[model samples]
Target: MFYAHNFSYKTASKSLPGAPDLDEEDSLEDAVVVFFHVEAGDEDNRKGCIQKFVKNTKWLCGKFATKSVLLHSFNHLSGSKSSPEFARGVLDEAVERLERAGYTVKTTPFGYFNEFSIHVAGDSLAKVFKEF
Candidate 1:
């Protein structure tokens, strides 16, 4: 599952103990925020799945013309979720790919609940959702 939003502002309000420390004290602006879920079935085509996800993310970023991206693991979208370890690895790989392509990437704390404050763009293209 994939859901993305072009945001003018976004910040993590609160996170669990294990969540990574935020590098930026202020809210991030001009970015695409992606909420994705990995299902257990995806394990059959892990590499290809990740590549498609990354490509779609880049496509959305291009539509918004932003080099910044935020990835959040959201399992609430479906019942058949992948193992947390594997899901996290996927996020990590996506981050590496995006960074290699010159996009600044940020991830919310994995395996934890976070409260985020976001101001999404008014343009219709700012919101995108897909399932694969």
Candidate 2:
């Protein structure tokens, strides 16, 4: 995940024309763009991913007084990515948990390539990388 000084996103086009949009053009300050990549290995450990994500989010929020998160699908982190369906499941679960934790969660729709701009923070914890 990358901490952002400012972040914004826009739904350019649907990955599938009939697919529903999950987000709209919006901007946020003091937020984190969670590029949640679902690796092939994550298919078998979905629960672990949800737990780790929540734990990491708690840490980030407390450390930075962050209240907003943008969940973006980014499969480039690893050579192997989970199936699209599996990834969606994981993403849905993460959103649910994060929202329950009182975070303002915004999600880019699954199965779509979106447009976004982010000004990454320069602080020590501005960018974080974790694998589960």
Candidate 3:
């Protein structure tokens, strides 16, 4: 399996069931964060990707399956702090996709400025990439 121990993602499964890659630290409140990419592509491909993502993510939301969900997309990640305008455009789509997937999805943005982020707490590990 392809692995990268040095990768930047830090995980904690005891808390979020699925051990989602967190974008922020745990608070007194219970929540997990996952930042995903929307990779460069055509409009049709992009829309299709979002649809498929929503479909699969819906399956992930099977157990802990609360209304809580979030979505973030980055065409490219240079740095988190320098891209508020991009966030401003796709943030709504993120919220919308989660809500459509049976999640209550918070309208509040996750993480510090420019950092593309999503909040998930378990029930989504099924969607993360796997190595054969």
Candidate 4:
């Protein structure tokens, strides 16, 4: 199983583990930010599961009419977590897919607890949750 907790944010920023001079900081506006969690069972059909993830992400972004996305690896959504390597790989692959489709994508630093400041739109559609 996997879960995608999504938000449509007016603005968002992530900072930690990287200095400003290193260009490791991230800031986005009018974007779909997805807190994605990959479960161990998802690896059984990795390719298919990833395909669904990408599709769901794109669908959510489209709903908000944004071509920008922020992918964050948040394993706390479930107890049975996939390995860090597996989860990181899933995030990377999703980035490639999103970019190929002409969306600007940013991913938080993997395997680390980063700080995020998100200002979400005040609407029911601004927040969505999906599990599969």
Candidate 5:
């Protein structure tokens, strides 16, 4: 499903920022893909980036194990005011969480960009989830 305005940062799809990629029903070696698509009219689109990311990370920590990897993308169609600061803040937070979970990550797309993706080792994800 897709939305255009004022979408929720957290969703049931598990497409949060730096969301671990888990096969769910399959092996952990595969990746889990989370797609966040917001319409142009959506409010708080800027903040949504970070919010979604955080939500995804929390979900990963709580519900998933290490064998899963997360691939996240916060996207909006043409229009609206998504800024670079939003992306930076979201990325910074995501990196922090990923690091804490023993996963290394990166970000891209300068100045009011689009989305981001996260990759973690199966061993690392498994290791992190081992605690839970």
Candidate 6:
């Protein structure tokens, strides 16, 4: 799994689940908004992926001084993406772990394309990329 995150003052995303009328907007403030791409090879060891995800997320949060996170499934970062089911599992586990750590976490619905907008803080540590 790979993640590209930005510390944003505000962010918003609308689900593009293919039904025009079904679009729903989700927004957050003072959050580390993460765009995650699950690679096809990461399905081999789910537990390891989850651990790495948590560690990397912790680092990101500490470095950016944010306690909130928004997870967005984004396969565009990699060419060898995992299946939707597998990707969802990783993302769900990550959310669970973060929540247990007492961070406010929100996730856009899985299995849907989304359109997002974010206002980044432009700090050097505000943008981070991690591979897990």
Best by lDDT: 2
Candidate 1's displacement at residue 97, Å, is: 0.4
Alpha carbon lDDT of each predicted model: 0.75, 0.80, 0.39, 0.72, 0.39, 0.71
Q: Which of 3 and 5 is ahead in TM-score?
A: 3
Best of the two (2, 6) by lDDT: 2
Q: Give per-residue CA lDDT, model 6, range 5-110, as digits (tens).
A: 4322222333334423444566777677777888998989888988988788777778767778888788755789888778888988899889999998888766
Which scores better on lDDT, 3 or 4?
Answer: 4
* lDDT by residue (tens digit), candidate 1, 1-132: 122343322335433355455533234677888889999998888898799889989998898787888888887568898877788888999999999999999877675555666777777777788677
Q: How much is the lDDT of residue 73 in candidate 2?
A: 87
Better of 1 and 6 by TM-score: 1
Off-target runs (Cα >4 Å) in candidate 6 are: 1-21
Clashes per candidate (backbone, < 3 Å):
0, 0, 3, 0, 13, 0
TM-score of 5: 0.37
Q: Give the clash count for model 2.
A: 0
Cα misplacement distance, residue 52 of candidate 1 (Å): 1.1
Residue lDDT tens for model 3, 1-132: 011111122222222233334544322122223345443342335455555655554554453343444443332344333234434444566568776655665422333334222333333342365211
Task: Please give the lDDT score for candidate 6.
Answer: 0.71
Q: Which residue pairs clash in candidate 1?
A: none
CA RMSD per model (angstroms)? 3.8, 2.3, 10.9, 5.6, 13.4, 4.3
Expressed as tens digits, the lDDT of each residue in 21-74 for candidate 5 is 432221122332334333433335546555655555555544444323343344
* Candidate 5 stretches greater than 4 Å from native: 1-29, 36-52, 67-78, 104-132
